[model samples]
Target: MRSPLRSRLVLLSTCALLLATLSGCDDDSGPTPDAGSQLPEDSGTPDSGAPDASTDSGIPDSGAPDASTDSGTPDSGAPDASTEEPWDGGYTVLEEHGDWIDRGRYAPCSFNRQGDPSTVRCDDLSRYDLSQCSPEALAQLDAYGIYMTDLRGEVPRSDGGTGLLPAFAGFMLHSDGGTDTMNTAPLDFRNTDGGTFFIGSSRTNPITGTTLTALAGCQVPSPGIITGCYARCINGSFNRAGTFEAHRMPSHRGESESSGGLRLISESPVAVGEAVDVYVTKNHAYVVSLDRISGTSGGLTVFDVSDRAHPLFKASISLPGDSSWNGVWAKGDALYIAGNDTGTLIYDISNPAQPEYVRHLPAGQFGVHTVLVDGNRLYGMSPDMVTLVYDVTSPLAPVLLQRITVPEELSSGGAHDAFPYEGRLYVSNGFGGYSVMDVTDLDNVRHLGQYVHGSFAHHSAVGTFAGRTIAFEGTEFNGSHLRVLDVTDPTNIVKIGEFRLSPVNSIHNLILKGNHLYAAWYQEGVRVLDVSNPTKPRQVAHYTTFRDGDPGRRGILFEGTFGIRVPGDGHVYVADSVRGLLILNEL
Candidate 1:
């Protein structure tokens, strides 16, 4: 069960809901609150009691060219063909490097020598040398699009030491010349200002009652790439100063919305709060949602997806006072839901379209954020930094096996999610880093080793490629991309390759099907990469599911694809934040 202290921390973290300017709870924190208008679960009724059949969601389309019109070939930017043989256990270990773009030195400016928010002040030009800033390039920026930025820099700590700071920001430049940011309320751009190629935004932290401000004196280092110095102040005191790189997220490398035959089949809206994750089983799609930051409720929304192109709404269920359902999965006749207020909620889905509620596991105030089913074993990751193992040999009834906790859980974050491959379990242990555990015997689970990347380890997909055990790991933060690690030797895991989109967005979940890696990238949309070579991942196909004006679009970094499932049924099931369940044709 979730402790009272952890529950309080969860509430306090939600106070700062802006993903761009403020950090929120980690993956284990359960359903995150979104900054959007509150609507009843039953609002915006679908057509004929089912999702609208239109491929378009009534909002503006992403304007990406149709992939069907492609010439049936990989993009020119794809990696060249390689004839390397399968891994024979001997290979070069690639060293990782910082993702920041360094542009020489900057003129330093002092803030409140004393740690006082009331003494914060903005030093726009004096803080950074702007002689290299190109107003012309900034002016050429797309007047109407969203720019997501990833920032990394150093700040003076109270202990007389320098600390590294990583942050994210989002800017929406309207076609009408007005600008907006995720730091402010949705559609409210009044607190933002920009001239030429520079942009700045300021807001008061309602939770802490402190003044927060940021200024970006930028230079267009390249097309679609904005890099420069930025200063942030809180409560009239200098909080941190850093270098930033912003990427225009609408399109990638001039590619259209889709490529390599991947195309959208249907888009269904979820009227129950903000849709985050989905599970497709027994010819039915089960989507779970979370309450928005506006204090709305979220629950389960079911659909009859027997028809790939048109999904019929079957049922919507929200508990009276506990409605935050973040993850969903099904096995046999059993359906499992990760509930914030409750543990794993079991349901009998023998009827497929109509599910019957069973009982909650470990009853009481247990917080299960995400769940995984491997054979007859069920893994429920809790925000309390513990992974609860269950014997689900009888799918309908689960028996608690044991609680697995890693040393990093307490100091880092908690158990966010896990992937069970072979006799090993790859755990995305929040800030605790990626942990590889020998779980062949749950009774004597042994810690293999851990890869402590300084990013928020969120989700991963592992597979055997060319006789090598490769894991595609991803973090959840601005500028967070995909890291390809060779984990065959868990103790000596090494990063062999990496794949990235815009730094402003984030990679959420990964699904490895054969040699293809399907990812639910938040703002960059659904990305399909060919990882046949593992080290050199190539984008073989993509489908953009995010549009600026989509319904439920909020001023939060996690505003696009959240959950994805490729069931080998020639269809891809996606749970998008705004558009709900998106059915796409598999490549």
Candidate 2:
């Protein structure tokens, strides 16, 4: 249940506008939900400003390691050189099979057309062939965890042909054999151990004002893998149908809950909304969250982290009517917070435990999704397709320098986030792709080049590796993974390596410390990759932060770790949507 004030805040934040640009929403036909929001649990809207906490390029000046010290050998927890081989950049890539099934002709289920989802029956097992399903093997699967399925199938096109459509779904199987799909409980969930799986759920489309029902059935091809088909009906009328391949996210590739030497030190629950990002400075950590549908208000949660094994709650602050704080950064005695309603919220943290509100910059309805500080310059990424540049030499009082905007052709998707490395600004422009800009001279800011990938460009971290400027970019959406690019020559950016987990999961924010790249991947948890070999990124360590019954576990696409910061500290700080602030031992 969302409060009226929050509802108004969502509208004022211009989330719809940001979604329209990032997703290319058709204005005339009404809004089409993003791939992650197709399920009921998702609000189909970006977090206020869609910012990632800890979006800074690297550790700040506050007693953190500098870039020059990042060229050391691999961390202690790296994979053994004798047993593990470097990745060849080869991984399973989903593709369309060009096969189509006409559900209207083969299945007895028909659209109700009356717009009543109750009349549509989805329990007809006769529609699928059970010969290939292995009941014995399925029954042996661990049935009490989370699974994310990726669907890549062909749908009927109006031209009497077929078109490819990719979809993603998440489900939680409880220890009691009960199942929940996308947070929709008591669904028509059934499974023969693990051999045959089926689930049906319904939701009302906010745009079409019609009920949409989805039914999925899969055969267990092997442990942790399910192959099947699904159908979506709108107003009881068959709208789309497709085949799917599901994979269990935990213990990937025979790995356990954790790998290498990464381990959890302590867990602190964040009472404020959905914890998204965090920053560490002055022996304190600042976590920012966004208001969730579960009715929690978003704000800042401060913790005195003087002791690595335990963190003391210092304070929690939620402004009346302005609680959507997404990103946080600090310098000197001034702390900068990315406020969706008010621009950059400045706080005087001279009293480390208590943050006194100083003031918000540029005043009046400025929405900043993420903030980054480099030297004396502060970068605020806005969903309005511009990056706000401010001079923060004075720390507390920042002076607006300019609003950098890319060309119209490359600005369709607004600037989601950016990373500064060596006088160059690598901007993750959603939909428009990744753009490299030269900001050596603010008055003459120039666009170097752009990488036009197909997904929504979200956040990135750049560093020099083996004499080459390497960037690790992560996109937001189903099947999005880490893409390691060689940006030595901005005009010709080439992908040299990549790392992937379940396609159903996503990587939110990441930081590069020396030879290690730490990523806060939702559901996949905290992943530490050894990128000493820029061409082959290998996972050296990991800590799983997602569990079955964690509070605010909605079983949606973006429900796990959202923000991560290394800061060269002996500990890793993460902001989990459910578990809140998690402190882990750094490898």
Candidate 3:
């Protein structure tokens, strides 16, 4: 009995052979005898008779294809009829045949190999056809049915600048009739040649209610890996273009990576459903749980990790209405938690392990998505598009200072995360853009400059290197990479560098300590980069925390490393999507 893996490889090889022939056997080995076998030498009209001996297209004559003969036109001399049914042996062909969805844009964006714009207006996939695909190409598609891809591209703004954003996408080609669409998941059919592919989709943006469409041209460099260029169109106008790459999601019994310099010393699973972030203070670790999907209760879980090998769960705090806790930070003896229902849930962690809930600041449904602490200040991002500043001189009580309103356009998308450095607060205003604000005066917060690119900005970390203020920002979606920006002059911030893994791998939370940048990059796991040269960021080390076989690992595409922390403890603590709290020693 042939294993599934073996069967897929056979299909890939067959597809490669068919496509190679159709393309004139461009490989170095030279053309085959029947290189242009599909092309007819003549229609057999009286003027163009006898199979033109002078024709140099390399196509051989299959007897004489007499279009005018008494007998109807003969075969174009295609090989075996069985091969024509590409999926007869081991594949299932999709039956549904109809025009794919096409939402036309005035000028569609198209990108070049360097992730720069090649053409502002390009063709859509409507003119593309899978029926022209070779048998091998069909087999290759059957072997790689449904998969997810991470997309990164720039959205040209009205102001003449570009916004680089991350987008999550999937490709689904189903044998069943209903879902044959492309460009994003659960849909089907992108054009294919051997393993090279072109996938696209058109839709209406739910937030802005604007028309949006995406098209990607990709090639399977390996059996399960795809790399490509993507173009995005918005509101009937050409936006921008970028590059993308993805790997097939690992199977249930997937591959594994042993820890290297980063050694897992201790680990524990949260009793709550999804453990998102962790904060370590003194001897105890405070982990926050998010009650996502379908859940009524979510709260904080305390673990005593005094021992590096084993951690003990101490206490859990869950409120009736306030359950979705997303972010956590420690200042002195106080622990500040960002709550979706309640504002900042203040806790007295003077006793480290035993935390006592004090009060919720601003006191109501504030919808604080994330929180950051710097000295005596507390920065909380409210989803309604404002960063609420508070004086936390007294750990138990937080006095609200000011509400800095984000621009109306960005604020509509909500504020996702914030980072405080020097006198400037770098806040990711959801899909609004990246803003550098002057929070020096809590009385009157001012927006110094903004990096509005693309459509999404989720999290960022900043630092000063070589006399220049550099910001390392990462968006949450497919194709998101670490973008390095020189923000010394907030008004004219320039993009200096970028680092990317697979397009399907996303970047979550990142921390900049000294010259090393630590990030919890979704499926690519924990990446440690040395950004000494801001123009070029180099990855120094990595600790993979995602295993496909891990308990609740699904195929939603975003399941992997969720959070990371490096608090000068000589250890890196990560909250993995499935493995829970993982403690590692950095290299």
Candidate 4:
């Protein structure tokens, strides 16, 4: 599940075999980024200081069961289908929690020594005297107005900590002393479209843009700064109220931009459509591609990487009726390919180069978007939000053990991928959100908790860092960033830290090894971060994979590094959207 996180679907009638069209271009000639500034390291856990588990602060209580959903039931209905809507259908109306933002605490301006603007902790826009601003600053403000955007708040859970609510605002103050107007980005709360709620009239134009809210008590304390409380509540159905402070311009420009750690070790081209995901074994690397559209076929291309510097294209497999393989993984001699329409396609890799087709699991028209193999169990995540667990004790014949279902409320599009640790299953539930389940007992697989932010297309990687079970989750969307959550207590999940490049570049797959996180960031290329201190992730290295002038560059949103694998081989394998397989020395 890479490109915008969806199952590769093509009408069976239009299936046609097409050889991968190769374009001649210099892969090694890609420019490396210069060492950029680093973000301030943040530590310490957020003390869950909310009043109570069910703090009904003027907001509608989540105590009542939503009418649209089954009553707290798991595995109760057919997987919810997803339309093109970015929300993806499964949205939980945040229980009304009246005005949780503490304006006083964040109002006093305090500049950090590092001077990193984006750090909300150091975000203090209270000192500027708007009346004393120079004519130039005022003119820029009068024209563009002060746009204070990126208003993010938290939606507390019934347990303890909170879920992230994505919200932003814009305001324009008329210089003629006429009426000032404020507007909000369409808020989709738990699937409910809370159309642009009006924030109040106080406005200011800072160095960057305008900042204002509709909430009546808001104030333009000085100039270019607007402080006020805002809430989104619809007919007492949902509510998430918070205080926000917006500056005219973004504080973190260029602070998060950096390049360089990855050096090209080797490169190989796959004559396929969109080289999406790749998996590596001792002697070979298996790369998969997605079909351009529905009709043409896209299949697997194998390369013998035993010779690291010069990987030879060994064999190519293109099935007549079954293609569109989105993911690839291998355990022992069996290769598991995520068959979009035919469940899990198993191939015998006893002979690495020429893999023999074994069979498809759960035979029939089923879409397996991703596959994860742990010990003797193989977990297949289907697009319908159901995970089929199989006892892969025998490589050839996998026995279906049990069907693990995502909670009905959170199972919107389906389960994108799953990571297993101890007795728990950490799943990246596409539109439903991120979930932690006790797969300890398959029969009574209970859901512990979930973290559903505004962003859909949540794909992930989980690992233990600093004695806490931290999951590095990224969403594949225009503004998606890497969110670090402490899953030690799934019931009380806490967001410990976050990392981002440009909001426009989407994050795909993340591989966590020890204290290092290898991220395949679309457009930004391959990024390596040091997570030794999970609370504040630091970007130590990066390799830019996308070039605006590259040959066959489709200029699409989901273009760049699609898949990445770190098999403890001291090498990083990445699947670039245009460059095919890219091998870099481990940072």
Expressed as tens digits, the lDDT of each residue in 1-587 for candidate 1 is 01122222343343345333434221222322211111110000000011132121111110112211222224334432333343344456787653332333332322233445445455444445556566676666665566665655567669999765455556666666443554433332232224344456555444534434444545665676677666666556666666666666653546588766788898888868678888777778889987665566788999988888888999988887678788887777888888877778999988887889999985334488788777778888876778899898898999999888776543255677888877888888866789988889888998998987766678887766656677788876555678888898888889988876664566788776555677888767788876656676777677887676664454446677888876656787888877889999866
**Model 4: lDDT of residue 233:** 28
Write down the RMSD of all candidates, one decimal each. 9.1, 7.2, 24.3, 18.9
Q: How high is the CA lDDT of each candidate model?
A: 0.64, 0.64, 0.55, 0.54
**Worst-scoring 10-residue span by lDDT in model 4:** 18-27
Candidate 3 at residue 55, lDDT?
17
- TM, every model: 0.79, 0.81, 0.64, 0.60
Clashing pairs for model 2 are 111-236
Query: Candidate 3: misplaced stretches above 4 Å?
Result: 1-128, 131-146, 150-220, 226-246, 250-260, 294-296, 363-366, 409-412
**Candidate 1 deviates by what RMSD?**
9.1
lDDT of 4 at 151: 38
C-alpha lDDT of residue 412 in model 4: 61
Q: For candidate 1, give the lDDT of residue 121.
A: 50
Locate the minimum summed-lDDT window of 10 residues in model 2.
40-49
Question: What would the per-residue lDDT of candidate 4 be over residues 1-587, giving only the tens digit for each residue?
Answer: 01212253221111111000101000111110111112231110001111221110111111112111211111112121111122112222233111112223222221122222232221122312223323332223222233433333445678998664434444433334433434312112111012211234222212212222223113444454444444332222223444445443222333333344357889888866667788776468888876653244567889888777888999888786667777877766788888877789999988888999999885334489888777677888886668999887786788999888887877765677777766888887765778999988888999999887634444666655434566777764434567777787899776766776542235677776554567887666777765655555666667667543355543334556888876645577788868899988765
Show where candidate 2 strays beyond 4 Å: 1-74, 80-145, 158-160, 173-179, 183-196, 211-213, 249-254, 362-366
Q: Mark the 10 consecutive residues where model 1 has the least summed lDDT.
A: 40-49
lDDT for each residue of candidate 2 in 384-443, tens digit (9 for 90 to 100):
678999998898999999889888888755677888877888998877889999999999
Task: Sort every candidate by TM-score, greatest first.
Answer: 2, 1, 3, 4
Q: Which pairs in model 1 have colliding backbones? A: 34-293, 64-257, 117-235, 119-236, 120-236, 120-237, 121-236
TM-score of 4: 0.60
